[model samples]
Target: MTDEAGSAGALTATAGGGRWPDLREVPFKPRAPWFNGDLQTIRNFLVVEGLGRGPAPPASRRMELPLNDGTGDRLLADYSQGEEGRGLIVLIHGLSGCSASAYMKASAAAFDAAGYSTLRLNLRGAGPSAGLSSDCYHSGRTEDLANALRTLQDQDDRIFQRGLCLVGYSLGGNMLLKFLAEYAGDFPVTAAATVCAPIDLAAASRWFDRRRNRIYQRRLLNWMLRDAVRLPLSSTQRDAIMAARTVYGFDEVFTAPRFGFESADDYYAKSSARRFLSGIETPSLLVEAQDDPWVPTASYDNVDWSVLPRLHRLSAEGGGHVGFHDNASRVPWHDRRILSFFEWVAG
Candidate 1:
């Protein structure tokens, strides 16, 4: 089918009250050999690069947005001008991930192929932005996002008319939710979506550190330490992050102290998106797997969905963390779901 026809199908797929796909009619069935959560989660690493990715994004140019915080910290993004009228999508990556992340590239390519211009944002010190910012990026660093949007708005007024959509993965998802809530009505955001975001920081940290999840925890912590050392920091700060054994420990020693929180617990409590969901006024989508390894299901359950009328929760019975490899297609399920939701909103 043509792209335009597909977009229309997606736009009409949403049920009343804005729920997409109506699960009873379109449930996610994981592909063979990846039917379970663990297998689904690891499949990305094992699969060949570009196996199912869409066409290469049209020629792109780099854009650096300086944070307004006066620290001289700047964020990097790859902007690709797509066919006009399709609008723009800003994609944020998960913990220790960047614009080059497999998921980010795949999603950007998919959206660009669908005619939407795309920007893959590398959070402070991530990807090409390493050592560009002395200050650290935490879940509540909405100001950086605000600065980026304002700068873009000033440069191109078309964003306001064509509309802007934000899509975040994992930790970035948490940050996006907070930004949507804390900065509601401040920007002309047409829609937003999060994939496997740990909305409750404290809960996710606890679950991640569990013995069953030690493998994933260790790898992520190592990436964090490696990236942290590249930034300009005092020896004391360097030592704290390097010596850390777990994600929580790393946060306690570096992220919390450096960001002015009393402790890791305080940092988690203050930075978690769960506290700000009620304030989100934009049409937002939250996608999570019931059997996610790192983020416990309770973290998602804790939110009182009834209070947030604008939020659409898609708690799939399977798909793992950021791994929604359905039997019907090679592309991850959430990508199609999100693109559809965006079409509906922009329609």
Candidate 2:
């Protein structure tokens, strides 16, 4: 009913999570016939993975960005060639996701069709980047995203037509916004877009572990655990990974302690993007699904929109996380929505 600052300092429309809003008012429409949030999510995932991957990007090459952290850590990023002057887009993935994730590939394909160059990044140690770092990637690893930006700027340092777009999904979205906010004016970024980002990590964590949501939570954890075992972790970190049954356990035993956090709550508070929304000045498109499994509405509701007139918020009625399906086609509608946002920001 009321969206105000809470203990979590969350700006939420509804206390628990959210209510079903009208689809007509939403930025994008769900595929015809089916509006069920669950079905929308499932079909989005199935279709994207099964049939709708779209055409693969041509002349794509995987390049490693040197972290220069003295640990010899290098993050992986894949580049797809596009027409020059159209701009370069750096794509970031969510928790337990990589550049090769179905959504990332589909979106890259769309960008390629538009003659835009794209980079699909593997944050630090997710996906094939699992063993690349001794430290694990958390929700607020803005440092990693910053490193990627600097690397890109070094390669394509030009002021003629600054058309770089920072695109992120889920946890990656949170990190992208935080990086732009904290390091404003330091990076020459033209635009940004985030889909289904968990701005408030604490609220999201609670919602994620809820009984009915266990299936999704378990799925993410399993993927994370697979990545955890491969890294060169300390005794505490390894033990934490071994004992983690869910994300909370993983954060408590590994993420918090490893990342210099006092506890999981501390990690969530400092790492959440909700606190930094007011500080963000970048032209960004923030998309959220009314029925997204974990990302809470409080994050979107609590944002100080007046301070971010350039920041467009699109709360879709049935996108289901990042699952914005075009229904008849395998390509997700989010691809175009993101590209449209980038184009508008570029102009």
Question: Quick one: best lDDT, which candidate?
Answer: 1
- Global lDDT of each candidate: 0.81, 0.74
Q: lDDT per residue, candidate 1, 169-192, as tens digits?
A: 999999999999877588889899
Q: Cα deviation in Å at residue 93, candidate 1?
A: 0.7
Per-residue alpha-carbon lDDT of candidate 2 for residues 96-171, written as tens digits (9 for 90 to 100)? 8898787788778877877788889897787766656756678887877777677766766662154778888989
Model 2 TM-score, all chains together: 0.86
Question: How does model 1 score by TM-score?
Answer: 0.92
Best candidate, TM-score: 1
Error of 2 at 261 (Å): 0.6
Task: Evaluate model 2: give its lDDT.
Answer: 0.74
**Residue 309 deviation, candidate 2, in Å?**
2.0
